[model samples]
Target: MTEAPATIMLNGKSRKIKQPCSATELLSELGWKPTQVVIEHNGQVIPRSETGAIMLREGDQVEIILPVAGG
Candidate 1:
């Protein structure tokens, strides 16, 4: 049998990940560059330097916002 996926709330939507992973890894998997985005984990803002250290958990809430440039 395979391991059940972990579920987390991402940007108000539910998402399933294969396993628990660092916030950095999750961002990488989603094709996001840590330096270009802001991450909020469980209602706490995560600094870019700490992204690699924050491990994601099941039922956790995460919000990722990318910077927009307009002229």
Candidate 2:
């Protein structure tokens, strides 16, 4: 039997992933560099060191904040 895909809210948009993946995997899938943004998983801040072990679940809300440079 095939497992159901996991659905998560990314940057306020609904997204469906093939399977449950860690935050690190998610970033890589999105083509984002770990140092380019700050991650907030399920309303809590996720440190870079912990991202690799943090498994994203269905219905999880993720906020990726990117720094802007302007004067």
The candidate scoring highest on lDDT is 1
lDDT of 1 by residue, 1-71 (tens): 66678999999999998665889999999999999899999999999999999988899999999878878
Residue pairs with backbone atoms closer than 3 Å in model 2 (clashes): none
- Candidate 2 residue lDDT tens string, 1-71: 66688999999999987665888899999999888888999999988788888888899999988889878
List, in order, the clash count of every candidate structure: 0, 0
Best TM-score goes to which candidate?
A: 2
lDDT of 2: 0.88
Error of 1 at 17 (Å): 0.8
> How many clashes in candidate 2?
0
Q: What is the C-alpha lDDT of each candidate?
A: 0.91, 0.88
